[model samples]
Target: MIRAILLGLAALACLAGAAGLWLTRAHPVEAARFEGLTGDAEAGQTLFTAAGCASCHHAPDAEGDARLVLAGGQRFPSEFGTFVAPNISPDPDAGIGGWSLTDFASAVIRGVSPEGAHYYPAFPYTAYTRLEDQDVADLWAFLQTLPESDAQSIPHEVAFPFNIRRAVGAWKLLYLRNEWIRPAESTELERGRTLVEALAHCGECHTPRDALGGLRTGAWLAGAPNPSGDGTIPSLRPEDLDWSASDIAYYLESGFTPDFDSAGGHMAAVVANFAQLTAADREAVAAYVKALPPE
Candidate 1:
């Protein structure tokens, strides 16, 4: 009887080991590449401003809005816990000066930093993944132009299993699409679709989250509760809004609603970014949102 019990325990241990191996396996995807270096620092600057990289990461109290200076210690409270945005400046020690272009691209597109660290979705890389490789490269170049700071990044204060960085590998496998936005031949709206998907990343905030905290695809851009504990993010569908697509476009560019209310909550920061965009890009985003079906 004793021998049988020992064998059963050993078999269970082997099964557990196998399960662990299966769970931890690295499923590598093809790395994205950009060719010919048409990346313009100017264009990248526009994209960066539109994306609102500074609103969350940069310390609000910093003297001037210099990207090189590390103004750490901004905390964002979420259901998972408080997440402090790290300094992305070119700081050799604390920031990303140590990163290569590939490393930077991985962080933006794959949500994994050079040191194999996983960034919380609060960093908004889900939307960022829609960016083209040239755009990503340009953003990298623009970042390099910033002065390097010496601010040490703070550790994330998330709870148990959520704190495990390797677990993000599972999250990526389930939700992230590695493909770039493809232009469809169907309509003039196709370019708008590409622009919205790659640049706007509307679904990140507006879509509902699944049990595993991934966005539910079928409900893309449908209004959902704010992750920042503020209030609900209202639907952008044309049916829901009493405004026209041009009105929406104007609002996005200028941060004013039809009622003359200023964009608030998380959207305030979003509008700040949008204010930096060109007239054409803002129109594309508005056109795409107006085309979305109502939730």
Candidate 2:
């Protein structure tokens, strides 16, 4: 009787393990949602610039018009490992040229790849998952218009369990969220919220994370250690910034602070992107930043 009971317990444990794996598998979006959608390249350029796609995807040290080439060799050092951005140009072999709209949508919003594998959170799909389908479609259209590059993608330098792509599924189950961190109360705020929370993914840098790499939502945009080991990413809370809405807007456009200090380090690239936006859009972002509560 004792032997039989032990065997049953072992069988139950095996079943539980299998259930866990199944629960953590990649979850792609329904292809039906994009059925009638068409992309506008003009609008997509706006989204692409706002999203700062070139900052990480451009060839290392690329400047001027060369920045437009998304050859993808930028290295992002993190606690997990150094993640090499992948080639996202229009090359069918080296990039995403062959990807279908469903594949793109799933990769963008669900953090699932075309081959049904989970993408590491280094890609920041957690924030992107909140993006509207139409904006994603536009981005896709804009991507196709760019020059193709034959440059190959470099592999990420991760170790053991962290290197296992399948393991990311489990991580996603814990950290991935579709809900907005700061829901908007008005139409103007809504635009700013979408830009900051979804498209630009400001919180991906500013928000601190848990031991499991899950964002600490309770202290949203309260700042985090720079993943690249430079220094702390500063808090965007109103108390910390202490800038007027106009001041913030001006800084975003010109990269200058009220004290006349200019944006340096990675923020310079961000300022470059924001400068591409319309004056009204910059003000909207400023308003949103000014409205943030201290965490």
Candidates in order, TM-scores: namely 0.85, 0.97
- The TM-score obtained by model 1 is 0.85
Superposed on all Cα atoms, the candidates' RMSDs to the truth, in angstroms, are 3.3, 1.0
Which candidate's TM-score is highest? 2
lDDT of 1 by residue, 138-210 (tens): 8878877776767777877999888876777667767777454333444546656655565556666777788
Candidate 2 lDDT at 289 equals 87
In model 1, where do residues sit more than 4 Å from their true spots? 1-39, 62-72, 179-191
Which runs of model 2 end up more than 4 angstroms from their true locations? none
> Positional deviation of 94 in candidate 1, in angstroms?
1.2
All models: lDDT? Answer: 0.72, 0.90
What digit string (tens of lDDT, one per residue) describes model 2 on residues 102-216?
8999999999999999999999899889999999999999999999999999999998879888789889988889898886888878888888988888888999999988899
Global lDDT for candidate 1?
0.72
Which of the numbered candidates is closest to the native, going by highest lDDT? 2
